[model samples]
Target: MDFHALQQRLRRFANERDWQPYQTPKNLAMAMTVEAAELLEIFQWLTPEQSLNLSDDQRRHLGEELSDVLLYLVQIADHGGVDLDAAVERKLAMNAIKHPPKKS
Candidate 1:
């Protein structure tokens, strides 16, 4: 997916609705958290195996919540002038250094 294009689309969506005022970084972060909670709610009562093997309907709902969380995250990154792809790469590198592989 073209992430930049997706971010632009989301920006236009909010612009058309005059929602920019409420899409501040703080608000977007909160919205993302709420969406994450909703996503977690779906698996609240499910076993690990059940979570791994969700029904089609459950998967659909999970996708919806996940989308919400991602879009909000994208918005937050955009507003914060963060390059999401680069940040992810940097974080992965840091994690690799922090947790190197064990020798066989």
Candidate 2:
């Protein structure tokens, strides 16, 4: 996805609604944690097998919570002037080196 465009869109969304004042990094972080908690709650009682086999209703709810966390993450990164693409690439490179493939 075009994250830059998405960030601008999110910014405009909040701006038009006058939600910018409430979209501070702190608040966004807190809100993301709450959404993450909600996400965790969805699986709190389910066994591994059950969690893997969600019903349609559970799947929809899972997607909503995931999006909530992602949206806040986008906003937070935008506000922090972080380039998500570059950051992800850098982290992935580091991870690849740290966890190199083992020989068969």
Candidate 3:
């Protein structure tokens, strides 16, 4: 996916709705957390197997909640002038160093 494009689209969406004022990084972060919690709610009482085998409706709802979380995250990163892709790459490298693979 073209994340930069998606970010621009999200910006336009908020701007069109006059929601930019409410889209502060702090608010976006909190919103993302809330959306993530909503997504997690889908699996709250499900067994591991049940979680893995969600019904069609459950999957649809999960996708909607996941999308909300992602959109909020993208907004937060944009507001902070953060490059999400680069950040992920840097974090992955850092994690690899911090937790190297064990020798077989």
Candidate 4:
């Protein structure tokens, strides 16, 4: 998928909701954390097998919560004027520098 296009689509979604006012960078950051916590709640007390066996309905709910988190994260990154792709590339470059190929 084209991440930039996806970002623009998310922006349009927020615009349709008139939610941009509440979606300041700081607020989006907080909302992302809150939604992430909600996603985690789904797995709070289940055994590994039970969690893994989540029904379609349960999975759909979890997917909604995860989407909420991702929406907020993407908005926050956009609001902060951060180029997420570039940031990820820079981090990977730093990791490469730190963890070079081992000698034979």
RMSD of 4: 3.0
Best by TM-score: 1
Task: Judge candidate 2 against the unseen true structure and give its global Cα lDDT, from 0 to 1.
Answer: 0.96
**Backbone clashes counted, model 4:** 0
Candidate 1, 13-82: lDDT as tens digits: 9999999999889998999999999999999999999999999999999999999899999999998889
Reference-based lDDT, residue 82, model 2: 92
Candidates in order, TM-scores: namely 0.95, 0.94, 0.94, 0.76
**Cα lDDT of all candidates, in order?**
0.92, 0.96, 0.92, 0.87
lDDT of 4 by residue, 1-104 (tens): 55678789988988999987897888888889999999999999989899999999999999999888877777787889988888889999999999997985
Clashes of 2: 0
Off by over 4 Å in 3: none
Report the Cα lDDT for candidate 3. 0.92
Question: Compared with the true structure, what per-residue lDDT tens digits does model 2 show for residues 6-100?
Answer: 99999999999999899889999999999999999999999999999999999999999999999999999999889999999999999999998
1-104: candidate 3 lDDT, tens digit per residue: 77899999998998899998898899888889999999999999999999999999999999999889998888888899999999999999999999989985
Total backbone clashes of model 3? 0
